[model samples]
Target: MLQIESTFDVQGDFGDSGLGKLLDMFRDMSDHDEDPGRFVVEKVIEKIPAPLRWAAEPFEAVLGAEVNDQLDALVPGAGDEIQAIAGALSDRARKFAIRSVLDVGLDAKGRKTGTHRIETIIQVFKEARLELPATELGDKLAPATRIPITLGAGEFEISEHRLKFPAGTMLSRALPRLVIPGVLGKVIESAALIARWFACADTAAKVAEKLDDPRAGAIAMTACASASKSISDQIEERLAKIDEEGRLRLEGSADEEGEGTYPAGGWRGAFRIDKEVEASIDPQRNTFSTQEQMATQ
Candidate 1:
């Protein structure tokens, strides 16, 4: 529980950073006919600690692709520049930004809310008992707009963080049962449908799983298709397809010349599983022999 107050120098250090890039981008956009939006400006202003000097001890890429999209939308054509600026950020500065981003507090203006939603890294460091360098040099430079700088969580360490994969295990159990009938029936009814399911792995990679190796991915997918074939189709039989109206009809045709014949224009499948069920534990269970019971006695 510590609070320190000092004017944050926005233009000097960040003149070559994303802050600079953003200003330059806006100027460029202004030069054109683009008005990005007042809402976007407010959003950025609310989140980033403008012109703050936060240092990362060693350069690292912590921002994910999600941030990349945000950056691109806010300041187009600044990817390389932002990367370069981030690479050049001091270790302490990087630590500052990350800490700020990790903290939970209102913005200096209280416009945005969430951890890392407001404030700069160094401001965060000062709260963590970090001794900050004097801003005498920046004091000499022309002051850019002053956005209030507040810091967040005073300290954090995520180096040992983990991602436990409950998802893969959950799906392995659930998917086999949930998808068996639809997938296997489609594969059997149209063998061509198997290719779609194989391709579906690629779709899932695009939307669900992150695939690292294409060859291994192919092997895994092939294995999945193979496993599905083993558990579902090997023990099951063709069932009548539900009609467009959602009715179940008999799949077999009767002879037209006899009473069993179907009409000439009618369509029907060749096979269907008899679905009458007679399940009971007493009926299906094996009875013990009298000698076995006597021996146990």
Candidate 2:
């Protein structure tokens, strides 16, 4: 299984009280269309103290406006106040950001369903900002427990558990058909290779500048040589197979003279009867066969 982990702190004055409110609000809103007021309520809930919830209600009303202004200042042409609120919440509360785990599973039809595990630690800091007490924010995240969550086409269950302090709590779920492991690995490998290529190129340029030698560029150039050759060989091999298939199709045609003739060259002399034979024969049968094989595999 592939695991992705990210950490962020929540910002603003509300703290854990605010975070809990926001999570509850989000859980409720997830089923409906976007609402800026609901989003603001969530953010405000993260910043204020529990005892101050009554005092914070009024501020929550203006949250949509405040969040909009912040977003407009940061991103031009950014519309949709609710979306802006969500984005700002994500940015300001990096510390409060939920750590989500998505478990991917595959079905017989090759479709993917994802189960999600979301968790975060809510901490209360001293007034001096020197130290704080950490606690699991909402629900405990457990490894094996599956919650009743409905993902698009696939059905999945999620279970959450709280962990002992000093040990971060974990929320995990079993998701079905989120993605094929093989495809995901290939994407990750491709991205890593691209990043490596760029790093090698940058290093080569730096070395060239320091050495003042034209040959220094070859250091980075050499790293890419093998990758380029591998890609080229794969393309050439595919093309060769395609060409052979085309030739075989042409050979199978009933008219001997018509076979292997260019479509543009007419059937007589420069327009020979054979040359005029249409080469636009549909390859749907072969294409469909190939597709079926791939799907089965």
Candidate 3:
């Protein structure tokens, strides 16, 4: 068996980059209160790299006007229902801020030991709920039913690191079957509803596989939208900082290691891909893979 270990540091801005442009457009829409309609989102979609287009295309369907039009025809006030869900989610997301901590314990031998655990904590000072109209789904669901948006603080540990596999490898296997948390899960439920409305049974089924029960309304989703913008801004800011020289060190065995630096070539310069890892291992087998990102503006 060949044991491999690596460490890398890379930083760069989206300067005139497609991703930067995409993030900027989203930020502008959220900041300026402009509607992120299908047409505008399509323009944003164009800014996504070719490799990411497929993953992003589904969202277009999820957020597009055509889908809303379709849903309104099927569920009458479905559009309002979605909006209410999104708003409810946004309220929940806003109620708690994410805090992270790194707890490290050293062994007496002075060798790095202990869990070296890092965790992201969502601390909720108070729990809150948003009410949604149940008549949209039918009388069985409660209209006055308060969907819990924020809950007791939960801690998620960041212990495992994944190596960057090729773009589609991980996503293709994970997305269709992945079950996500309540925040986005509610949105997925709405998406599944929309997909079924279009008679896109396959899309609906796939979306259904990712759904969580008892959806949160628009307010919760609104918070997710806000969080999405925050995430976009953070990514853009980090990418913008990649300058001059970037470094990578790879160790294939206890005795063998390679270290190198590549010029970020400044912004918008052609990026060079220095390495590629090909493994034929089964997708079910968990393994670690790491790759450095090099991008041109």
Candidate 4:
């Protein structure tokens, strides 16, 4: 058998040319703030190449109007100084905003994870290998199988004898079936409750299949807004109970320390409280609760 091992590098590349342009625009705006007609504004306008100038004209007009409106609302006086600052900053901000939307990893930290680095190296190796010339060894090995084998860049036909395999050799086939663990089964059941609020069909059935439960189809059909509400209430109750238990533990610890010797702030007081507050207001947290309820239902 001819083996063609290959690797693909996935780390990508560095450089934020788009972001750099944005920073430059911001700098120019700052520099032109004092004198509205500074060299920076003209330099910025001039920086736009002739080919892009026509397309950018409409954007420039819109940006100017937006700057004027914003400055009028923000600053008391719509003076030349304000206009200059606004114009320069607005232009840069618009460009940067557009760039940000287009650019992935714009705010990613410099740290390269092992997975990313490994993928990048693999891709580089693959590119390097593809540059190598094809060998005659690959051509010679193509004709000995039952399946017709095409070898070399040019398409050439091979007979069935070229692809023959020994009888009774096991042919591995992948089984396509849902394999839900106990924990994930519960999660799917809970998510079904949330899915009900969105009028999702087959939520119960999907959950049942995931859990390998007999009543999955029936339960999925019965999932509704009321079921979602019940799940939400259950989650809230559990969280409250957990909170009360934690508080009791803290109070007990404080009592043991005698008067005026309570621990000011530990894990619960600091991180836990903040986390609870954040969770209470977070939309994602509510969604998670809904999902959990559906999965467990």
Count of residue pairs whose backbone atoms collide, per candidate: 22, 43, 32, 33
lDDT of 2 by residue, 1-297 (tens): 222232223233322332323323323423333343334334333433343434444444444345344434544323243343234333332222223344434445545433334344332211112122123323332332222222222212222222111111110010011112433323223422122112335434443444465664464345334443443354334323322221101111111122221111111101011112212222222110000111111
Model 1 compared with the native: what TM-score? 0.16
lDDT of 4 by residue, 13-116 (tens): 11222222322433443454432223211322234445433333334333334433433444334424333333433232221000000000111342211110
lDDT scores in order = 0.24, 0.29, 0.28, 0.24
Cα lDDT tens digits for candidate 1, 36-84: 2222222222232322102210111221233334445544543333333
Compute the lDDT of residue 11 as modeled in candidate 4: 15
- Could you tell me the C-alpha RMSD of candidate 4 in Å? 33.0
TM-score of every model?
A: 0.16, 0.20, 0.24, 0.17
Weakest ten-residue segment in model 4 by summed lDDT:
95-104
- The residue-by-residue lDDT of candidate 3 on 190-225, one tens digit each, is 322122223233323322333321222222233334
Tell me, by lDDT, which candidate is best: 2
TM for candidate 2 is: 0.20
- Model 2 spans with C-alpha error above 4 angstroms: 1-38, 79-297
Alpha-carbon runs more than 4 Å astray in model 3: 1-69, 80-101, 110-114, 121-187, 190-297
Best by TM-score: 3
On lDDT, the stronger of 1 and 3 is: 3
